[model samples]
Each structure stands twice: as structure tokens, then as C-alpha cells.
Target: MAIDVKPALSPHLVVDDAAAAIDFYVKAFGGVEIGRVPRPDGKLIHAAVEINGAIVMLNDDFPEMTDGKSTTPPALGGTPVTIHLTVTDVDDKFQQAVDAGATVVMPLDDQFWGDRYGMVRDPFGHQWSLGQPVREVSYEEIQQAMSQA
Candidate 1:
């Protein structure tokens, strides 16, 4: 009956330490904590956050449900997917994440796609790609660059 959340495709993450992860997101990515629901056991059942105008839901892993398949990225031998963030200043954003305990997966570099980009592995084993648009490229230029790469 309630329709407060409007994002149709928000990502829901399961973190081993939801509280810490929430704090990290707030500090490193400028996320706003909008709502949180906690369980009787003092674990978070659900937490809603807004990151750069996009909703990203998260919660602590519940081993009781789904037969313990709610494992973290490290437990599953690393995640195949990476979260990408587009910020105004790639350098500043990248450094903030690093200072907040993210390890560099790929150093910052300007790419053929006309963006300053870099990758990082968060403390909780999540990979994040930081990017900032530096220039606009035509479709033909992108095709040519793709062919060369």
C-alpha cells in the first residue's frame, strides 16, 4: 500500500557487516541514509540509502533464509559484478574511497572512451568503478576506438 520508494531498478546488496558498510557508503560515496529496519537480534533487516540520487538497498546477511546462500563476495571467491559510480571529480572521489579503506583495483587513467576512470575493491570485497566524463565522443569515434582495442 506504501509507494515511498520510486526506483524501479535499485540494487539490493547483502553485506556481512551492514552497519559498517552503510557507514562506509556514507563516508566514501556521499550516500544519504533515508531509512533502516532492524531485527530483534540487533541486525539490520533492511536499510535504504540514496547514492547520487539513486536508491541502493542493503541489509546484513541472514543465514537462516535460503539455506545459507547469502554469502559475501569473499566467501564466494570474489564477485563477478562491479558497481560503477559517475561523479563530478573522479580524482577526489577515488581518493575518498581509498582513504575509507578501498584497495585500488585499477589505477586512475584517462581512457579512449573520454572518461577519467579507475577501479577499487572495497573493504567488504565489493569492486567499485569510479568515473567522470571528460569529453564527448561521437558514435563513429567510439566504434573506431573499440576496433583498435
Candidate 2:
């Protein structure tokens, strides 16, 4: 089924190759490609994928389309923004992403905030953080943990 909920905020990515990025997202995060609109030159002008109930929009790097303002992460050295995904199985999902050609940026570890979390960078230069809550963590406890850390 297609994404039913319309999120107030959704990430829109400018990638070097929108089609390849969509394929990678599907393999790595079990994303569903909802739609794709291509330019006359055959490059994707707009594409939407749904992952974990959220829509992630993407398009090929068309500098002319944005008055040369928008660029891909590689062109900017690296991305400062990281998409975060909350999953039921962080380890499994993390491994799946890795198996699908994502490079590990951080090893999966249990954090003081009660989550098993890690990060990966996809081949298209997008970074993603995968997290799973392993236990209930109170604000006070988190504060204490932060203080200790």
C-alpha cells in the first residue's frame, strides 16, 4: 500500500542519480517507491519513496532547476543532515543496509538513552541513523547518563 499519512516535514534529497538512489533505498531500508516523474532528458525530476511510514522525496541533481543553488552531498564534501529511522530491529536493519552497500559510519551499540543505534552512509552519499529502543529511559535517567558521559 502507498503512504497514507501526509507528514508535515519530509526530507527532499538531491542525488546524483535519483533512480539508483531509489533502488538503493528499496534494498537497504525496505522503502516503497510511490512515484517518479522524469525530465525530458530522461533524468528523474521528482521521485517519492516511503520508508517506515514517512515519505522521502528525491530528484536528480539539476542545478539549473534550482537556479544553481541545490547540490548533492558529494559536491558539498559531505552531508550535515542525517535521516533517522526508528525500527523494531536496529541490528537487523543496520546489517541489511550494510549488506545493501551502505558503509558503516558507526557500529551498532546500546546507548545510555536505552536505544541500540548506529549509522550508515549510502552509496549515493546520504547518511542514515538506525535506532531501536531497547528499554524505557526516563528523562532524569537520560540526564544522569549524559552527565556521566
Candidate 3:
């Protein structure tokens, strides 16, 4: 029998500075801290935050620990994976993140795929793609747009 999971998937971030990362998330994305468990050494063992009703788990990197084989995105050079985000107002959200210390990787623009989209790299070195659906575009429409370009 399979065990039931409340949230089957959650992104776990390992950063050099978990506390700063947590603060960044709160200010940048309006995330609320659900809880945090600190180790005896005052390092974050685990933390949970809610972003737009979804929980994101994170912790400070502890390569010394058996369970902590993870390194920060910078330590790994860069992350290939990016978090895709949707908001009611993509432009506002993108600016909010930028104002909170995220660097704009891609300027916000309307895409042929029908989304107002942009990308930002947070201070903690995580890349986020912010988007808002502007209209419903069929596959044929996308193909036509691509062909026109």
C-alpha cells in the first residue's frame, strides 16, 4: 500500500545561508514562513515556507552531515532547473522580485505562446520564470507566430 502525501512534491533548496534565503523569499514573493527547525549549532536543519499557497522546503547546506550532500546553486556553478511561476500580474511580480535583490535575467515580454513572461535570478542563485497567461493560443497559432518570426 502507498502512503498518502499531503503535498506530493515540494522544491527543496539548499543554500549557503538559509536564513537570508528565507527572508528573500518572503520579501520577493510574499512568502510566509510556516516553520523552521534549527540544529544545535544554530544552523537551519529544515524550514518550510508558503508561497502562493504552496510549500517550499529549504535548509542550510551541511555537507558534513550524512543527509546533506546538497550544495548551493553557486557552488554548483549554476542550476539547470528553473522554477516556473504564475501570478495574476506577471509584471508586478517580476518587479517585486527584482526590488528584493533579484537580478533580471530576461526582460518581461509578451511571448508568442500567449504569456507575459520574464526570468530573474534571486540573490540565493535560484532562477525563477515568472509568467501570466494573457490569452489562449492554439498550437496552430503558435506555429504561425514562429513561422512569421
lDDT of 2 by residue, 31-112 (tens): 9999999988879989999999899999999888777865898888899999999999888899999999999999999999
Worst 10 residues of 3 by lDDT: 62-71
Full ranking by lDDT: 2, 3, 1
Number of the top lDDT candidate: 2
Tens digits of per-residue lDDT, candidate 3, 54-94, equal 88999998887745465888888999978888899888889
For candidate 2, the lDDT comes to 0.94
lDDT per residue for candidate 1 within 1-149, as digits (tens), equals 98696537887888888888889999888889988899888789899889888888989888778586867787788999898999999999999999988899999999888999999998888899999999998889999999988
Better of 1 and 2 by TM-score: 2
Provide the TM-score for each candidate, comma-separated: 0.90, 0.91, 0.90
Candidate 2: Cα lDDT at 38: 97
- List clashing residue pairs in candidate 2: none
Clashing pairs in 1: none
Ranking by TM-score: 2, 1, 3
